[model samples]
Target: MKATPADQQELLRLQSIDTRLQQLAHKLGALPQTAPLAELAQRETAVRGTRAEAIGALEDARSELTRLESDVAVVEARIARDTDRLQHTSSVKDVQALEAELASLAKRRSDLEDQELVVMERVEDAEVVVSSIDLQRAAIESEVAELEAERDAAAGGIGVEREQTERDREVVAAGVPAELLAFYEQRRARGAGVGAALLRQRTCGGCTMTLTGSDLEQVRRSAPDDVVQCPECDRILVRTDESGL
Candidate 1:
């Protein structure tokens, strides 16, 4: 294919942009914050699970405390009834029975109070667990937010630059012949982002293989308007005065 020197140089420039675009796309995919954010999300899920368990424990403790307090109230009412009987009855047997019942009631009430105290302590401990989990969640969220902001701020500039570079590539590509650009794109796809290489100092910039002997002579003999392909890697060999041809 025939291309003027200027058009050939434009192809090289387009190649440069495409290469950088490929790099930018890779960078965008592998943003620094992405892995950490994912890890933090997993930790967040685990922490929320812990919080859920803490809530369940607190609820159970509160429920047990309520039931114990209710039992204590019932016991106190029974003792009051027995005390009233004592005040009214003068029989020895009746007085003795009432005192025995009151003593038993007192013991029951003491046991319920102890159980209530234990439940109350569990509730307090559960509350502490909830508080600790909440702090952990807040710290994780703050770090996630910070990482997200950093990723966005850092990527913002690269994103804009990539967009502009892509636009410029389009404009430059439009100036080239359709067949040449298509060929370049196809070769770029097959050659891993390099369709054309600068033939500098007898070296194939695409493959880094030096052209020598008859190969170098062939490139040297080629007309300036004619496009040349490297014999080793089959990439377009773009020539300049520095080609050492």
Candidate 2:
């Protein structure tokens, strides 16, 4: 393939813009927020599980407390009935028996009341745990939202810049010969991000590999309008005044 010296230079400029565009695409795909956002989402799920368990514990504690309260009420009722019996009894033995029964009911009620207090404490503690977990889940969700927004804005800026760069590439690519442009595009389609580069100071800019010995001699002998490719990377080497031919 052959292109004028001016066309070769335009191709290099077009390559530069295309390289920037590729880099922008890479940055957009590998946004920094991606990993952290994923981690935050996992944490949110785990914390929510903890919150669910806490809620279950709270319900269990409340149920126990209710049972204890009912037991205490029954015991107090028995004590009241026994005391009324003692007042109506005429026999000393009956009175003594009624007092003894009242003492046993009082002891039962005291034990039930104590158990109720312990369960109430557990319920309060579980409530605190649930509340703390809820706040944690909310914070993680909020952070995830913020990171997503930041990532989107960054990608949007890259999108605008890439659009502008593409416009410039189109204009520069217009000046290149059609056959040469088609060849360049084919090379790019074959997974070569760079289709062309400048040969400056005997170095291939595409691969940053300096040509030496016979390879250097061949490029040096090639005409200025001649299109050449790098032996290492197969990218077109565009000759320029700075090529040190």
Query: Best-fitting candidate, measured by lDDT?
Result: 1
Candidate 2 off by > 4 Å = 35-149
* Cα lDDT, model 2, residue 181: 90
Q: Output the lDDT of residue 8, model 2.
A: 77
- Residues forming the 10-long window of minimal summed lDDT in candidate 2: 183-192
lDDT of 1 by residue, 1-245 (tens): 88887778788998998989999989977998888999999999999999999999999999999999999999999999999999999999999999999999999999999998889999999999999999999999999999999999989988999999989998989999988888888888889889999999999999999998999889888899898888988888899888887
Model 1, residue pairs in steric clash: none
TM-score of 1: 0.55
Cα deviation at 106, candidate 1, in Å, is 0.3
lDDT of 2 by residue, 1-245 (tens): 77888887887888888989899888887899978988998898899888889999999998998888888888888888888888899999998898888888888888888888899999899889889998898899899999999998878988889899899988988888899899888766663688888899989888899999999998888887888888888888888778887
The TM-score measured for candidate 2 stands at: 0.52
In model 1, the runs with Cα more than 4 Å from the true position are 1-26, 158-245
- lDDT of each structure? 0.91, 0.86
